[model samples]
Target: MKKLLSILTLSLFVFTSCNDVIDIEQPGTLLAENAFKTVEDLQLGVSGIYNRLDNTTQIRFNSVYTDELAIGDDSGGQNVTQYSLFLTPTSGMAATLWNGSYITLNQINKILVAAESIPVATGEQADYNNAIAELKAIRAYIHFMLTTYFTTDYTDDSALGVIALSTIPGLNEDLPRNTNGEVFAMIDADLTAAAAGLSNQSSRTFISRDFITALRARMAAYRGQYTAADGYAATLMANYSIANQTQFFNMWSDTDDTEIIFELERNVGDTYDRQATGGGGWAGSLFAFVNSTASGSPFMEMSRSLYNQLDAVAGDVRLARYIDPSSTISATPTTSTDDYLVTRKYPGHQSQPLMNDIKLFRTAEMLFIRAEAAADANNLGGAATYIKQLRDARFGAAQPLPTYASQQEAFAAILAERRLELAFEGHRWVDIKRLGARANVSIDRDPIDCTVFNACSLSNSDHRFTMPIPLGAIDVDAALVQNPGY
Candidate 1:
C-alpha cells in the first residue's frame, strides 16, 4: 500500500494543477518514493491516517452531523445554521459529514494499498500491517455510519448507493455510490481483516483485537445477525471489563484511560493549540454554550420523554450528572430561560472542563452491545444481567435490577439504557434506526415550519435521513446518482 500513498499524493498534486513547480527543487535528498522505506517511515505514514480524525472538518463537526445533536436554537445566526436537520441540501452538517468521511476513506485506502508492498521482515512491516488493518477497520466504520444516515433500509438488500469513494485512484474522479449490501460487505471484509491482524496485540489507544470484536458485534447487530453479534459481544465483555462509573465519566478527561479502546489524543503544547484554534478546531462551541450557562450560551432543552425517563428513576446519579435542575441555572442571576435546562454530557471548558481526547470506542458501549445482542438471542436473563451490571454501577448497588417479563421487555430496557448511556455520543440515531424496525417510533425530523415540540414527530421516512450527495460530487460524475427526495 506504500505505492498507493505516493500515487494518491501524486494524484493530489496533479489534480490541484501544481505540476509546474515539480521540477524546481533544491539540492538532492531522498525522493518521495524512497522516503517511506524504513519502519519508522511506514509507522509515520500510518500515523498520518490517525491524525486526520483530529481535523475539525472531519471529527469535531462530523459528530454533530450525525444524530447526536441538532443545531440548537443558538445556531439561529451562525455559519452552522445550515446544519439543522430541518434544512435541506445546503446543510453544512450534512455536507461536512459527506465530504470529510470520504476524505478519510481515501487516505485509508491509500495506506492500505501502499502497505501491501512493504515486506514484514522489514522493522516496520508488521507494525505497518497492523496500522493498515486498523485504518481499514476505521474506514469501514466510517462507511457504516454514512450508510446508516444515507440509506433508508439496510435490509432492503437491493438499494444501490455509494458512500464517498471507497478505493478509486486519480483526483477529481467522480464515483457513484455502492449498493447497501456492497457497502456492508466491504465493511465486513475490512473488519474481518482487522480482527485477524490485530488479534492479541498490545498497542496504544488506536485499535486492538477487542476493539475490532466490539465493532463486529455492533455491525452484526445492525445487520440483524443476532447470534453472531451476541457471540462477539459476549467474548469481548467477558474478557474486557467495563470501567467503574467514575472511570466511565472521567476517562474522557484522561487521555490514557484503560477503557478507551481507540481515541484521538491531544498534547498540551503545539498539538493542543492547533486543535483549540486551528481549522481543525470544531469543539461545538455553540452547542457547548447552549448546554451550559458558564459558556454564556442558550441550552438545548432535552426532549420531554428523555427528561421524564431520567427523572422517573429516583436516585439516578446520571440525572444529577447529566441534567442540571432548572433551579440550579436559575440561581445564577445572569441565567436566561433559554439556558435553564441543557444536557450535562458536555459541560464546556469552564464547568466539568473540556479534554482534548476524542473518544472513538470505549468498553462501556461493549457491555450495552452485549445486552442488546443477548436479548435478541432470547437470553433475556443474560441481557438483564449485563444491563444491571452497568446500571447498578451508575445508580447504586441498593437499586434492584429492573426485571422484565420477556425478551421483548428486556429489549425495550436495553434500548432505553442505550439512550440514557450513549446520549450526545452520536449513537442515538443508529440506535433509533435499528430499533425503528421493531418499535413504532419514527426517526425523521419535522419540516422547517413546524414548531419544536411538534417537529420531533417526523417519521423515519423523512427525506433528510439520506443526505444529498455533495453538489461538487454530483457535478463532476455523470454516473453519480442522487438519493431520493433530494
Candidate 2:
C-alpha cells in the first residue's frame, strides 16, 4: 500500500509538471510507451490511472445538470450552460468528459500494450494478472461513464454509445458510436476478469475485487438488470460492513473510512496543489461555503423539495452532517429553504479543507442500488428491508419502517430516498435519466429558484437530459452523430 502511495506521489509530479501540456487527445502516449519497460513502469501506469479518476469537468457537469441542486444566486454567472440546460456540442463540460475519460483509456492501453510480451517474475505472475485486471476494470468504468452521459437509453442495447475501442486508435481515425449494450458488454467482460484477479482485497483507494463487485452492482442496476444487481449487491453487503451512525459523518472527513469502495486520494504534499485556487478538487468547493456570510454565497444550493425530504426524514443524521439547514443569503431567495439549501455531502476532504478525496464508490450506494433493484423486481419487502436498513443507519433505529401499498409507491419512496442520500455527489442527474428511461419520470426543477438562471423544469423525455456528444469529438470524427435536441 505504501508502495502504491509513493508511486502515486511521484506520478502526480509528472501530471503536474506537464499540466499545461496534457492534451486530452494525444495524452502523451509516447511518454507512457517510453516509460513502461519494467514492472515499476507498470506500477507508474496504475498510479497515473488512479490520479486522473477525479476530474473537475465531470463533477461540475454532473452536479449542476441535476434536479437536486438549483443555481446559486451568487454563482457569478459561471457554468450557466449546464445550469440552464443550454448545453451545446461545444460545451466545456461535454468536451472535458469526452477527452478526459478517453485520455485515461489511452494511457491504460499503452500500459497493457507494454506488458503484453514483457517477462513476468515467476511468483509475481498473479500480481501482474491482477494489475492488468485492475486496468481493464478501470477501462470498463470509463467506457460506462461515457455511455451514461452520451447514450439516450440505459437499457436499450441498440442505443448509440460513445466511440468504443479496446486499443488506442490512430490520431486521425474516425470511430463510430458503439451500441449501449455493446459498451456494457465490454464493461462486463472487464469486470469479470477484474473480479477473478482482484481476490476481494479491501482497499479504499485501489480497485480491489470487492470494488469491481460494487461496480457490477451499480452497472446492473443502471441497466435495469435488477435480479442480477440484487445478487451482486448482496455479495458486497455480506462481504463488507457499513459505517455506523457515529462514524458516518467522520467518514467523509477522512480517507480511512470503511464505507468507501474506491476513492481518489488527495495528499497535502502531493505534486499537484489540489487545494489551491482553480485546483482539481472542486467537488466540495462547488456547494461548500461554510465560512461565508450573507454576502458571500455558495456556488450551488439544494432544491427546496429535496430539503423537504431531508426535513421529514425524522432525525436525519445527514441534516446536520450534510445540510446546514439554516442560512440566509442576500439574494432572490432570502433564506436557504427548499430551493436553495447548501450541501456539504461531497466534503470528503482530508489533509486540507478544500481538497477532498473524490469518492468513486461507497457501500451505502450499493445498498441503495440493491433496494431499488429489489423494488424493480417486485420484491417490495426485500426493497423495504434494504431501504429500512439504510434509513435506520441514516435517521436512527427508532425511525419507523415505511409502508408501501404498491410498487409505484415503493419506487417513489426509493427515488426520494436516493435523492436525499446521494445529493450533490453526481447521482441525481443520472438517477433522473434511469428512472425516466425505465418508468417515464419527469424532472421538475424549482421554478422560483431556476427562473433567474434561465432554467426550467425538464420532462423525462427532454432531449437535453442526456448530454450531447461534444462537437470537438465530431469535428475530429464527423461520423459521430449529435444527441437529439442538442
Best by lDDT: 2
Clashing pairs in 2: 303-338, 304-338, 304-339
* Model 1 stretches with alpha carbons more than 4 Å out: 1-35, 54-84, 116-122, 163-166, 170-174, 199-204, 255-258, 270-286, 289-305, 324-339, 342-344, 347-353, 378-381, 403-410, 443-454
Looking at model 1, report the run of 10 residues with the lowest lDDT sum. 13-22
In the range 211-283, model 1's lDDT, one tens digit per residue, is 6777777777777777787788777666656666676555544523756666656543423333233334424
Error of 1 at 169 (Å): 2.6
The sequence of per-residue lDDT tens digits that candidate 2 reaches over residues 291-394 is 22223366677666566667764677877667654554333543344344656665544445445676778888888888788778788887788788888887
lDDT of each: 0.57, 0.69
Model 2 misplacement above 4 A: 1-14, 17-33, 275-279, 288-297, 329-340, 346-351, 437-440
Pick out the ten consecutive residues of candidate 2 with the lowest summed lDDT: 1-10
229 Cα displacement, candidate 2 (Å) = 0.6
